[model samples]
Target: MLVFGHCFTKGNYTIDAALKGLCTEEEEELERTMMAYWANFARTGSPNGAGLTEWPRYGAEEEYMGLGVKRQMANG
Candidate 1:
């Protein structure tokens, strides 16, 4: 279902005034999964699945996805 990347991200990008670009493949995979989930949400108001939590629109005080800053890194 529609899930927020925060549900899978458990690391901080910075600590102690230090800017450490900590990125992991596992995190990237999680991000991808979350993005796909959102695609389903966009097409339909609800995500199709069993036992999945209901996804609500942001600003609605309900159990749903929450968004944080999304940034991209360049390797080329």
Candidate 2:
């Protein structure tokens, strides 16, 4: 399953500011990106969305997107 946990996203602390902290442009952009991903995933089976990085296929690499203040891809 996709891990949107504290270790993945900005962290649990940000939850407290979820209602008020999206004031910055970057924060708003990230939120919009996340919402789009979720919406597309709900409509289709894939989480792909416009302007989002290509989600790598599950394989031996074990790669995933570590979404946070700095969104990036990681392998474990």
Candidate 3:
């Protein structure tokens, strides 16, 4: 249930932890989605991609992606 530092950890940790049942299915899904976003952003300038949730640019709305068991867009 600890999401802190997950993005900085190795990808194998996510897969291994999921395979070992150390993480919930929801957590795994969120990690995978995050990984995809990161990879896409590294390849391109933006994180937006097909099949993934839209990551809106930061603006006056102060919107941001709320990463958790249930990932969603949240307004600050």
Candidate 4:
């Protein structure tokens, strides 16, 4: 299982900010995307779904899916 810090960021980029309802549209979308990714992974073995970017498999490249204000792939 992979662990990430997607849902841990929000308006204030804090845990409390994530739980509150004062998040911006980007923050809200980030939360939604993260949830969908996790839900898809729960239903299937992979996090890739109909509209999401293909989550790359972890390997020597050491890449990861970034769930920040803007969604993108990043190298770890």
What is each predicted model's overall lDDT from 0 to 1? 0.45, 0.65, 0.74, 0.71
Give the per-residue lDDT of model 3 (tens digit) for 1-76: 4463354455657544544535666776777888888989999978989888889899999999987777689898
**Range of the 10 consecutive residues with the lowest summed lDDT in candidate 4:** 1-10
- The segments of candidate 3 whose C-alpha lies over 4 angstroms from its true place after superposition are 3-19
Considering only N, C-alpha and C atoms within 3 Å, which residue pairs clash in candidate 1? none
Per-candidate TM-score against the hidden true structure: 0.34, 0.64, 0.70, 0.68
Candidate that beats the other on lDDT, 1 or 2, i.e. the better one = 2
Model 4: lDDT to the true structure: 0.71
- Candidate 1 per-residue lDDT, tens place, 1-76, comes to 2233543434553341232234355555556655766676688755533433344444534344442233322221
Which of candidates 2 and 3 reaches a greater TM-score? 3
Residues 1-76 of candidate 2 have per-residue lDDT tens digits of 1223322245447654454433455555666778777888899878787788766667898998887656889998
- Deviation (Å) of 76 in candidate 1: 44
Worst window of 10 by summed lDDT in candidate 2: 1-10
Please provide, for model 4 over 1-76, each residue's C-alpha lDDT reduced to its tens digit, 9 standing for 90 to 100.
1123444553445565445555566766776778888999899988989888789898999998877877788897
Q: Rank by lDDT, descending? A: 3, 4, 2, 1
Angstrom error at residue 24, model 3? 1.7
Cα lDDT over the full model 3? 0.74
